[model samples]
Target: MAISFAQCFLAVDDHDKALAFYRDALGLEVRNDVEFEGMRWVAVGAPSQPDVEIVLEPPGAGPGASPADRRAMAELLAKGLLHGVNFWTDDCDADFERVRARGGEVLQEPVDQPYGVRDCAFRDPSGNMVRFVQPRGR
Candidate 1:
């Protein structure tokens, strides 16, 4: 049996604002934007990696989360405590410059990580940390 990663979700306060960063700044393609069950579902993916997708949805969107729970989730997202995904880039510096030029809030400049990959980070419009990493040799 084989398993592959499919989709991941990020809590977003506004769909359009998230799109501005993910689609415009990061250059990910907008794969889906539609309404489902009274909620908007938006998904974005790297054009080079069609198999993986990232979904941007509102906080506290889970069926079982109470209003208070949802509020807490939103607060966490606002505080930059949410766990956002990392992206692998061919050129970390180029990607960092591009994102920064587009007004992305820089969290860290590109630096060689002791762990092996060079990386940089930024805070998305909703304050989630989005990291771009390039393997040292690539």
Candidate 2:
């Protein structure tokens, strides 16, 4: 049997703002957008990778979460303490510039890493540190 990634979640305070960044800025296509129990989930994926999707969700979306739990999660997300996703790119510099030009919050310029990949970072509308990496010497 082979295992593969299906989806991963990222917390966002505003779905529309997240869409502007993920779809418009990064060029990912929206796979699905659904609302349930007064919460929303937006699934987006790179057009080249149809099987994988990133689910943008509100903080404390789980059914078991309490109001205080949601508040704590929102605080963590606001502080950029929540985890984010990294993407593989063919051209780190070009992708970096594209995201920046589209008004993404820049965290770092593209830089070659000692471990052999060039990468850059940006904060999403919700303050998650999204990174793009391209293998070195490609």
Candidate 3:
């Protein structure tokens, strides 16, 4: 049987803020958000691409998570060091503007890359690193 990356989990300190960045700014679809016993399982994905989902999980969602690990995770998550997520777009400039309007910080403005693409980077509300790219050779 073949396998694929269905989704990736992001342990964030503020799930709501992360959700807003993904749903409101990038216009991703909210697939599921179920809460039980003061815990939640939330996710969002591209509207046209249902298989690619990002689950917004809590820092201590893992098994036997110690206080030190939680703190370390939180710190790394804030510095935009935990993960680097990238999306392909038709227009990087427009996407950057849209993200900026939604309160996402422009870590790097749109620029031509040596790899034959135009890209921009942003720091999401939860400090996650997101890169948007578009082909520039067209």
Cα lDDT computed for each candidate against the true fold: 0.92, 0.96, 0.85
True-structure Cα RMSD, model 1:
1.0
**Model 3: how far residue 133 lies from native, Å:** 1.3
Candidate 2: where are CA atoms >4 Å away? none
Tell me how candidate 1 scores on lDDT.
0.92
Which residue runs does candidate 3 get wrong by more than 4 Å? none
For 1-138, candidate 2 gives per-residue lDDT tens digits of 999989999999999999999999999999999999899999999999999999999999999999999999999999999979999998999999999999999999999999999999999999999999999878
Q: Select the stronger candidate by TM-score from 1 and 3.
A: 1
- Tell me, what's the RMSD of every candidate? 1.0, 0.7, 1.6
- How are the candidates ranked when ordered by lDDT, highest leading? 2, 1, 3
Query: TM-score per candidate, in order?
Result: 0.96, 0.98, 0.90
Best by lDDT: 2
Q: Give the winner by TM-score.
A: 2
**Across residues 25-110, which tens digit of lDDT does each residue of candidate 3 receive?**
89998999987757677988998787889888876677688889978888888777787689999989999998998888889999
lDDT of 3 at 135: 89
For model 1, the stretches where C-alpha displacement exceeds 4 angstroms are: none
Error of 1 at 135 (Å): 1.0
Comparing candidate 1 with candidate 2, which one achieves the higher lDDT? 2
lDDT for position 54 in model 3: 87
